[model samples]
Target: MKDLYHPAEPSLFTGRESANRAYLHENIRTVDLRSESTPPTGKVPALFGYACDEGVRRNLGRPGAAEGPRAFRRGLGKLPWLQEAPDGLADAGDIRLDTDRLESAQQAFSEGIAQLLRSGYFPIGIGGGHDIAFAHYKGVRTYLPTGRKLGIVNFDAHFDLRSPGDAPHSGSPFFQIARTCEQEGFGFHYACIGVRRDANPQVLWDRAKELSVLTVAREELLGSALQASLKKLKTFLKRVDAVYLTIDLDGFSSAYAPGVSAASPMGYSPWEMMPLLDAVLGCGKLVSMDLAELNPAFDTDGQTAALAGSLVHRVLHYPGLF
Candidate 1:
């Protein structure tokens, strides 16, 4: 466990530190989950970084997302803590990928996530790619009671249900998770928001249909169809014992989130996603969540990274969810 974990550093979280006002960095605590720590009396969110992009490379997308965790921290560092502060916000550090094998890294990440869940911490994963979803789902499912249905709510442009081919990649996480659930005699419930019709092939659509994956297309969330989309999301949310929320930056218009492995020109805006986010986070069913595919290589003036940071800030401050 120690070999896979790297402790968080204060240097990574740098902002205008002040005693008078509480900022995210000012109160964040660095923890080593490899060692047992006392469970917090109240809800505490623990941030863990999956610092590997081999999945992105394998998926034929851009690299450099391996640095995404650091960028996300730097992006979040200066944000003000508006919510009534908790005892501490935990940073469990990065699950570093020390080799070329992405599978091993993903397994290590799942183990770390399972540990956090067992410790009674709300795990928030900062990702190297959307592939982290498979590992994250595995971790959450492992921690939950057997036969409990795990619903996946993914805000992404692509279905990510593509077959793993020879090995799993960013595009194959959901399919991989579905397979895992099937092999283990559990259920796979998935709802994908912000799907782009142009982005997915017919085969992938067929796969979603076969899996009964509920999807809210990009166009539906653009105008009058948004409420209908929200209704669909709500219905999906009601069907599972717990939900795993993952935001692939590419789900948003390239204008809103340009620093991603995949960029969509016709994606929806962040403003359009607020109500949906509120619906999910307020449901109190979220077990774990993640932000994926924030590749610094394509980011312009750190805009996407900052947006990613702001999203996490919103999640932490969002009412009704721990």
Candidate 2:
């Protein structure tokens, strides 16, 4: 695992945006270049980034999410924390792909995460692409007890359940997961919020139904307003013992998050999205989580990365019931 990734730089943590204690660069732990330093004392959540975008290229999409980790770090570095504990933050650095070996990279990522969970740290991943979900799921699965079911709550516009071609891509994470769940005899309970009708085609829709996936279409996500969506999500969480929450920044409108690969003009706002996030954190079943698809190239004023970073801050600080 040593050469599989680069260690984080302490320089990335220095910024004078404010005098407040919200600056992540000052507070976060950086993995040393030589080897791992001792794990921070206490039950703190560990954070890491996936800095590869080969999944986007494999899917025939834009390139640049490889820079997501750096952008997210810059955005996150400026925030001020309110009543947060200092020892709770650790940055494990980014997972690097071994020269077109995305599968190996993913497995390394999974093992890294599994290690974090085994050591009593809540693991949160910032992904280069949505494909990280499959790896993230694998890490979560490694820690769960036998016979336990895992549920995923994804905030995205598409199902990401397309069947794989020669290998896995960003579009086929859930499909791969669903198939594996069947083989492993574990129930795949997914509740997706903010699915866009125009973004996904009919076959994907039918496939989603076939898998018995619970979807909250973009319109329905805001049908009775955000509180209703939060309530529905809360109800969905009751069906599983543990959870892995994924946020694809593309789920938000381009106006709010313009840096994503496939920006949507018609999507939820930060105002409309946070309540549901609050509810997800409130559910208390969260075992792992990921924030994906923050393409800084298309971003305006670092809004998308900053938003992802803000959400990352929230999730990391959440004192979960687990």
Per-residue C-alpha lDDT of model 2 across residues 55-92, encoded as one tens digit per residue:
87888767788788888887777676556544647777
| 10 residues in a row with least lDDT, candidate 1 | 80-89
- TM-scores for candidates 1 onward, in order: 0.97, 0.92
Off by over 4 Å in 2: 17-22, 31-42, 84-86, 223-228, 319-322
List the candidate 1 regions with Cα displacement exceeding 4 Å.
none
CA lDDT of each candidate? 0.88, 0.80
Highest lDDT: which candidate? Answer: 1
Compute the lDDT for candidate 2: 0.80
- Please provide, for model 1 over 20-125, each residue's C-alpha lDDT reduced to its tens digit, 9 standing for 90 to 100: 6578888788778768888877788999999989999989999888889999998787888875555668999998886778988888899999999998899999
Query: lDDT score of model 1?
Result: 0.88
Clashes of 2: 4
